[model samples]
Structures are given as structure tokens and as C-alpha cells.
Target: MASSLTKGSAATGEKTFLGHPSGLAFLFMTEMWERYSFYGMRALLVLYLAANVADGGLGMNDATAVAIYSVYNAMVYLLALPGGWLGDRVWGARKAVAVAGVVIMAGHFLLAVPSTASFFVGLALIAAGSGVLKANISTMVGQLYRDKNDPRRDGGFTIFYMGINLGAFAAPLTIGWVGQELDWHIGFAMAGAGMALGLLFYFIGFRHLNPVSSRVPDPLSAAEKSAVVRKGLVWLCVAAAAYALIGLAGVFTINYALWPLTVLGLVLPAWSLLRIKRDRDLEPVEQSRMSAYVWFFIAAAIFWAIYDQTGSTLSLFAKGHTESMLFGFGFPESWFQSLNPLFVMALAPLFAWLWVALAHRSKEPSTVAKFSFALVMVGLSFGIMMIAQGAAAGGKVTPMWLVSVYFIQTVGELCLSPVGLSMTTKLAPKKYGSQMMGVFFLAVTAGDSTIALLQLCGVPTDTQSWFASQGALAALAGIAVYLYRKKVKLLMRGIH
Candidate 1:
């Protein structure tokens, strides 16, 4: 009966697009352009920082550039928790997304200014604004369905996912070209322009969105709102005090501050888990499922730590170690960033079909097993890179070497990327459902910070040793998870 109601709700005389709510079309387009601005700026950041001072770049060494990128990248995901909180309790998702887009556009324009101080400020703004947009938009997509059981939910999200990649794919080719061939600031301005265009598009089509877009998911009472504000103020004071102490200790540099901030960011997830574990209302099955999720979280973090190098370490390899001439014409190495998304568009459907075919034969792998496979495959990609490193010792290796690496990693991504959050939804307790996805994104934060931490510790990612070691560790983790897959499956019970 509930399913019938869900079906009926979907059939309301409301406007539809491709059998899904009309909201998806605008949401998809907005997200695509949002990603356009994001990936556009990101593709330039490290290169700009690492380029010679004479070339209008920041002139930082490779290590500093990579560490800075890691911090900014990590924070983008880390702050999503509070972003989600504001969406759930204060502003509605619609307002949150709109306001965040404005902030993001401002950030890109700020980055276009050629001052060091403004650049850092711009990064901070983008990271915070991205958090708000990132955490709430997908939840808004779910809201469009009006019911959890709507069969269109997965298909709708899949299309939305393609939007993300579409933006990522287009940004590098366009923005990368302008940034490399012309003034870098102009490219940044172009990114801001893309976002402006996106926002205009979303506003023009705003009426198509589901009504729930303007309703906060879990609004607090007046007293509760006051309490939340007080709590936020207290946390702010604590953070300020901590910063003062670090300054007094004579270690107040950007590098030192970032590590502490990352540590604090990581603590949120641990606290979230501990809070969940203490929920006495949960049944034994829910507790068991949470335990299984912990392992999944750990494995997913490892995968992201390796996969996200496309913007940092792998990017460096592309610019310096890989030959860039194609048909004797020079091109920007940032164009390589487009490959992962291109592969996603090409292979996602193939993999989608492969999974269904396997399921028909009763041979589909459990989520846990698939996670294991992803870890191993991503690890193997790096292991292949170690071989590429050997080849580079003679001269610049072919771009195909990196292409081959990306192809392998994209395959690995297909194995785990779509599965992680979907499993989070299935496994969450009702009480924590709204916050679980936010917590799940913390895996990305943790993974990016891990790279920064390694860099700070003098473990350069460009080294053959770093590649071999991390690769082997990831593979071993995969093997251990595979060996114990049955045990984790038992905890999940009927979840898979």
C-alpha cells in the first residue's frame, strides 16, 4: 500500500521530464555548470602554484603546491557536515544551493585577481560554498521523488551523476586551454562566467523544481535554534583558542594550521560513529550493519586517497614527465583531467549492463566484495605507474602510460564509486538517515588529507618508493577485506 502511494505520488498531474520530475533537468544542468567552475579552477591551482615566479604563478615547489591542493580539496568535503546541518535545520536546500552558487561565483572572480592573499581567500570561499552545495543537492534530488521507494530514484541520480562528469569533462578542455594559452586569470574569469550562466539557467527554470526544495528537511523549534546557535558559538570559541595556542607555540604557518584542521575534521566522523553506536534505540541488526559500514568506510577512503591523485601527483606527472606533443602541436596537460570523466561516460553504461547480466547468472559480487575489487584494481593502477616511472628514467614516457593508468583506475572507480553512497542509504538507521550521506563524504576528506599528511612527512608522491608502498598497502588491504568478506556480509545480514 505504501508502495502504491509512492507510485501515485509520482503520478500526480505535476510536470515531468523523461518520466522523472522536471526538477531533474534544471538540477542536472546547474550541477554540471557548477562542476564546470570547480574543475576549471582546480585544474589551474596546482600548476599555477608550482609554475615559476617569473611566469605569474606563485612559485611554490612541487611539495608545497601538492600539500596546498590537498588541504583545499579536503576542506571542500569536510565542511559538508555543517552545510547539511544548515540545510536540514536553518535554510532549505533551494536557498542553500542558490546562495552557495553565488558565493562560488564570487570565489572564482576573486581567484581571477592576481594577488596571493586574494587567492587564499578565494580558495576558502569556494571550499565552504562547495560544501553547502555538495551536501544538500543530492538530498534535494531524493526529495523530488517524494518517496524512498520510487523506482525512478536510481535512474534520476544516475543522470545527475552524468551531469557532474559532463562538467568535469568540458571544463578542462575549455578552461585548461584558455588558462594555458592566455592569461590564467582570464581562464578563472571564464569559470566564473560558466557558473553565472548556470545560475541564470537554474533561475529561469526554477518553477520546474519540486515544492519540497524550499522546505527545510528538519526544521528546529525556536528554542532548539537558539541552542544550536549557542553550540556553534562554543565550537567557534574552542577553535579560536586552539589557533591562539598554535600561534603561541610558534607554528602558525599555513602548513601547520592545515594539519590540525584536518585532524579536527576527521574527529567529526569518529564522533558521529560513536554517537551512532550509543543509540540504545537501535536494534541489534542495525548495530551490526553500522559495524559493516565502518569497514566499508575505511576501504572507500583508501580508494579515494589513490584515485584523487589525478589532480595532484598524477597531474604533476602529466605536466613534467609525460610528453605533451601531439602531432607536433603543444597542448595543456590539464586536458588529461578530462579522461576520467570521458571514460565514465563511455564505460558506465557498459559496466551497468555487466552488473545486471552478472546478477541474472547469480554471479554478482556483494558490495563488500566489489569494494575489495576496487581497492585492488586502483592499487594495481599505481603499481603499473611504478613501471611507468622506470620507463620515465630514460626520457619522458608517453602520455599513453598515464592514459593507461587512468583507464585502469576508472574501471576501479566503476566498481566502487556508485556503490558507496547507495549502500550508506540502505544501511543507515532511520534516526541518522539525513546525516549519513554527509558523514559518508568524509571518506573523501580523510583520503585527501592523508596525501597532505604524507607530503608533510617528506614522503613525496612523485617517488617510485611512495608509489610502490602505497600501492602494495592498498592491495593488501583489499586482500584482507576479501578474505573477511563473508564475516562483514554476515553483519550486514540482508542489506546486500
Candidate 2:
């Protein structure tokens, strides 16, 4: 650990970029373009699937398209477990990120080809590639800052996060317009080009990166590697056999295909918690911290389940139930997807300043309290949507209603998302730090999988009922968390 710390510190004295390390700038740009490709594709996916075949779409039903969307998103999260392990143990973060970029670009290109087979194939590739890239890239950012106590760490991360939002904010307006009004395949091609540009920048800036990213932090012994390979082959064979059986039974629908992933979503967190609990090497304090994180995990899952609907259910609502014309010019439904990230970019600085101001005055809310507030805010957004349903003009509400929903949800995201990341890092046992991060992402997987299953069960067919139920549940969950805050704080063992 000390040696790792020493390696991290090596880059500290190097020249700064925008008052931070230069490597961060490279990472920031790389992640920005990657997110551009990702959110661009995301903004189009459901709309493309549900649109009529005559309109250059697959003509899938809303339920099917949404289920596929959920499963794809869920897989992207689930595969991060192996993805991060591969980076740490086999390929190193640098090589893993590079390979992921290539794979993701290929996925986007495949989507640009305009065949049903290519559509599923493209989505599979994107999910797999994003899994490999997402966790490891962030890990590389941490490697750039050697001092754990560096006051600049939080601000650096804020800057990096803004890059993510920048990409997200731009992709929807550009790619969304192209896909909705021009050509769907052309939009996918643009996404591929965006990733290609990101890769080009990565190659150009590779030399400036910290050396730690270029080598595996933990390499397995040759014997252990051999054993892992043998086990992997066994699992592969088992999966193949199961897939064959499912195909033979003629039950290979989107919902059925996602059943195994949904099961894994439920099982993975349990397995992670059990492993943490049974680890004899962990100190009692470490065990207690892990226990506290469990509550956070659950809360975060609920929050994301509501927040992530912006790309799926909300996108659909904007398309069908919202009036898109402003000043007699109709805009693309996908354009509405940009609202959250745009709001995020605009509001994040104010929220950061507010937190610091409150802290200075010794009046800041506890982390758990902030999470509760996030839930309530998200619930209120849904409640507003429920009201909007009744207030629709000629079966279509104004786009501002959904825009307002995104704005409120962005506030909730500001409270929960960064705080959750900070809490995970603080509460994680040193030995299991990376795995704990993987578990945190599983919270997202849980939420995506849960919502997907609900959609499959026709829960979202009645938008009014769906919004009302989600709003009520989220609000109630917030109150429950607030009530239980004292117990959670005790379990936190002094971690604020």
C-alpha cells in the first residue's frame, strides 16, 4: 500500500493543467468524448426501436424496447465487475481503456449498418465495451493524485464530472436532432465518429498520463491465471448450454433473456456483502463501515431507478405526451434528453459552493440527510409529472413540464450522485476499495433491472399511475431513511 501511495505521489510534482495535474486534462477529454458517444446513442435507442419501420426503425412495442433498454444498461453495469478485475489483474487500466474505446466504436458502427441483427449485435458490443471502460477510467483519475488528503482532489473530480456532463449535454442536441429529423443510421455513425475522435485524442495524449496507469496494480501468479482461465472456460460452456436450451424452448424474448441478468443483479450485492462479512482479515471497524454502506447502496439504487428514467420513460413521454413545438418550430424529442446534464452543469457549482458555505457555518446536513433530501426532490419531480398528466392540453402537456421535471431531478442528482461516490470511498475497507466501488455500481444495476422488470410487467403503460406510484414510493422512502438516520450514523462509526 505504501509503495502504491509512493507511485501515486510521483505525478504530484509534475506541471499542472488548469491548476491540476496535466494528466487529468487528457482523462477529462477522453471521458468527455466517450460520454458524447454513449449518451448520443442512448438518446436515440428507445425512439429508434419504437418508431414505425417505415420511419427507419425496428417497430418494436414500447414494452419490448424499454425492456431491451433496461437489460442493456444493466449489463453495462454488471460487466464492470469483471471489467475492473481485468484492468487490475490482466491488462492494466491504460490498455483496457484503449481496447474498450475500440470495441465501443465498433459497436456504434455496427449500429450504423441498419439491420436487425446488427442492432442487437451493436448494443451487445456497446454494453460490453462500456463495462470495460467505465470503472477503470475513473480509477485512472484517482491514480493521478497521490496525496489521499490533497485538498484539490474533490475539485479535480468536480472538473472531471463536468466533462461528463458537457458531453452528455451536447450529444443529445446534435446527435438527437440528426437521428430524429435526418437519419437514424447517420446518427449512429456520428456516435461512432465521436468515439473515434475520443480514441484519437487518447492516443495523442497518452504520453502525458501517469505511469501507474500503464501497469497492472495487482498481477496474478501464473498458476492463478491458469486456474482463472480454466474456470472461465467452464462458465462459458455452462452459459452456452443454458443459452442453447433457452433458444430451443423458444423463450428467447427480451424479457426472458434478461432474467439471468436480473437474477445476477439481486445476487451480486448479497455475495459482496457476505464476502465482506466473512473476511477474517478485516478489522471490526472495517466491517462496521461495510455494514453502513449497505444502507447507502439501497438508497442509491432507489434514487437511480427514478433518475435514469430520463432516457427511457421520460423520453417516450416527451415524444408522445408533450408538445414539442416552441415558437411554431417543432424540436426533436431526443433534444429534451439534454436537460438533466445541462442543468447538472449549471447547478453543480452553486451546490458545491452551498455545501462549503454550510460547512463553514457548521450547519451542513449529514451525508445521510442529503441522500434523504435527494430522494424527496426526485419524488417531487415525479409528483409534478403526475400533476402535468392531468394538466395536459389536448392530450399533450407543454415541454416545459418535462423540462421542469428534469431540472428538479438534477437537483436530486446533485445531492445523491457525488455524495454516494464520496461515501463509498470513505466507507470502503482499504483491501476491498475497488470491489466496493463495483458494488456501488451494482446499485445502479439493481435499479435499472428493477425498472426494466416493471416495464415488462406493464407497470408503465398508464403513465399517470406510474408517475404517482413512483413519486409516492420515493417520498415515503425518503421519510423512512430520515427516520433511520440515527441508526445509520451509529453504524458509520465516525465517517461523515
Candidate 3:
């Protein structure tokens, strides 16, 4: 293990994989397998719950299944708050991630045991573990390159993004096929194995990590340290309140709840902005950028609300309505999940090139422009699905319907997701970057939770109706984007 660690470090420092750290490859492959396990399990979730008792699965109603899926997904992102906080405030990124991996590995193992008690227990572990690993790992990648001006940063992120999708692409096919066709336990067990591999690689490559990478310095002044602790506690209270409200409200009522939770989420940051405005501790430009980060968070949440349906409503749509076939061969329904990642791998380099070219010419779109475009592309993807809905209502739509939809959406992701990550790192004040990353992941949490919330609200589980609803929701989201375009652009001013 020590030898492997040394070898990996040497490789990472010496060669840039596609112009960034070879360590990027290490992170990429680790994330890929982790995602494969994650999405692999995800593809099985609804099917498992909704399947008959004789199928070696839990027979749950579609609404309940989706609701559970949403909560689980949301928790994964929600944990990022504590995970990132711990990295910034206590353990640092490397230790936090290692601990998270172990917890997840244990969680996956619990699931493989085949009991209702174990099942929920496994999910709880997974959620807690994900909270630790998910947010910090991305920040660590952003840490790798020294130059904020390095043209390779975006491409590196895109490549890392591809690894995530590649895992997603393969997971459903491999794990989904085994679980659905052979034994569900087989797929569940594979997820555990995947995590073990991820942990193995991550630990072996730990030495390659730069000491400066996300190393939170000891708070210089007692006052500063005290402020961080206080702020962190405030966030903890806020997250608890958010979760409490969700539990108290019925699933359908969660949408109404978002307004208040959204307000609550921003309270501290807003207060910080006011302080900045007063010139209490920060400069005017710094204050503006901090305020801009808050707005970016809002826009990001809105985007994820539309994008994250891939795991919930979209997953159901692929299974139920869309035709899944390649020539004479019928592809596993879960395999369709790969389209997003597949397109991501293909287009990431191109998008990376486009951004650099435009930046060089002073023709690059503002961060807000990039964000708006991401929303527009996401809407366009849904628009195509709406067409597929019409076709499927008549009969089976071609599998290409889903593929083509994922293709367009992947373009939107290339615009939105990784750039959103970059935007946070760039726009946020240095003292607050990790925390801001945590906040960014929170948007993902809300968006994912919203997907399940919608499913519980009215999204159909039956074949034809579900596709139609996806189209309608997509249209609504697009309208929301159009209305918010100018507001989004205003936030870009403080961003470089």
C-alpha cells in the first residue's frame, strides 16, 4: 500500500492527465466506482420497492418509493454540510474523506444483509457517510491546480465529472441487470464491493495529496475561531430545522415548505452580507461577491430541482414508458441512466475548450450567462422528453428518446454543474469557500428532495402519464428560468 501510494504520488506530480494532475485520474476512478455503486443501487431502489413480494424485494407504492428515494438522495447532499464543515474546522479534507469512505463501505455491507432493519440502517450509514465525502472531494479537486488562471481547471473538473457519469452509466447496467434479472442481493452486494475499491484507491493515493490542499489553517485570532464555531453551530441548527419541517409536513406539503426553508437557509449569509455592507470587516468588492454567492446558490438550487429528476421521476420514466433497445438487443432499463455521463465524457473537453477560447477573446459568457444557458439547455432536454411523451402516449417511444434527451441535458450540465462548482470556488471569499461549497451542495439536496416531492405530489408511476408529467414540469421550470434571467445576470457582476 505504501509503495502504491508513493508510485501514485510520483505519477500525479509528474504527469498531467489531460493537462491536470494524474491525481485527478485517481479521484476520477474512485468517484466513478463510488457513483456506479450509488446509481446502481438507485436504479434498483424504485423497482425493488414497487416489485411484488415474490420478487425478493419490498413491495411499496410508487409514491412512497419515490418519497423515500428523494429523502435518501437529499440526505446524501445534506451531509455535505457537516462533511465540509468538519474538513474546514476539524479533520481536514483527506481524513474526512477517508472516514466517509469507511462509513459508506460499512453502509453498503449492511444493505447486503437482506433484512428490513438492515436496509434502513444501511441507508442511514450511507447518508451520513456521503455527507462527509461528497462535498470535500470536489473541493479537493479544485485544490489540485495552483493557478486560478490555469486553463486546465475546467477540463480537469469535466474529466472528473465524466468519471462520475461513467460510473453512473455502468452501474445501472451491471448492478441493475444482476439485481433485477438474477438476484437483487447480487446487485446490492456489488455496491458494497465498489465502495471497498474506492476506499482502497483513495487511501493508496492519499500521499499524493498536496498538504496545502484544503488545509484549513488554525484560526489566527481567538475571535475568528469563535466566529467560525458560532457560524457552524448556526448552520447546524438551520439544517436540523429544515429536516424537522420536512418530517412534520406531509410529502405534498414540502413544496410549500421550501419558501420558508429557503429563507431560513439564507438568514446567516444574509446577515453576513449586511455586515459586509456596513464595512464591518470586509471590503465593498468582497461584500458584493459574498452576496453574489448567495444568489448563485439560489439559482443553483433552482437548476438542480429540474436536473435531479434523473434519479426519481426520470428513472421511472425510462423503466415504464421509453423503449429500451439497441437493434435486436433490449438494454437493461437502468442502462439508460448512462446517457448523461456518456454525453458528459464526450462533451466535457469541447466545453472546456470553448470556455478558454471565449475567455481569451473577452467573448466568454458571464457566469450568469453560463448559468442561464445551463437552464435553457436543461429545459430543451425536457422539451424533447415532452415530444417523447406524446409519442409514448400513442405507443412505445424509441429508446433513442431517452438517449437524445440525456444528450441535450448533458450539454446543459457541461454548462451548469461543473461551472457551478467553479463559480463557487471563484466567487466566494477565501475564508468561506468550503462552507460555500457546503451551501452549494445543499442546493443539490433541496433539488433532489424536490424531485421526490413532485413524484409524491402527482407524478404518475404508470407508464404513459409519468412521461407527460415530466414534460409539464420541465416546461414550468423553463418558464421560471426565463423570468429569473435578469436577476441571475445581476449576481454575475461580483464574479470574475
User: Number of backbone collisions per candidate, in order?
Assistant: 0, 0, 1
> lDDT by residue for model 3 over 256-357, one digit each (tens)?
433443343335334544543455466556666666666566556666766766766666677677777778897767777667767777787788889889
**Full ranking by lDDT:** 2, 1, 3
Model 3 pairs in collision? 79-131
Which runs of model 1 end up more than 4 angstroms from their true locations? 1-14, 234-252, 327-329
lDDT-wise, the better of 2 and 3 is 2
Shift of residue 303 alpha carbon in model 3, Å? 2.1
What is the Cα root-mean-square deviation between model 1 and the actual structure?
3.8
lDDT of 1 by residue, 316-357 (tens): 888889998766877799998899999999999999999899
lDDT by residue (65-105, candidate 2, tens digit) is: 77778878888998899999989999999999999999999
All models: lDDT?
Answer: 0.86, 0.87, 0.71
Candidate 2 clash figure, as a count = 0
Candidate 1 or 3, higher TM-score?
1
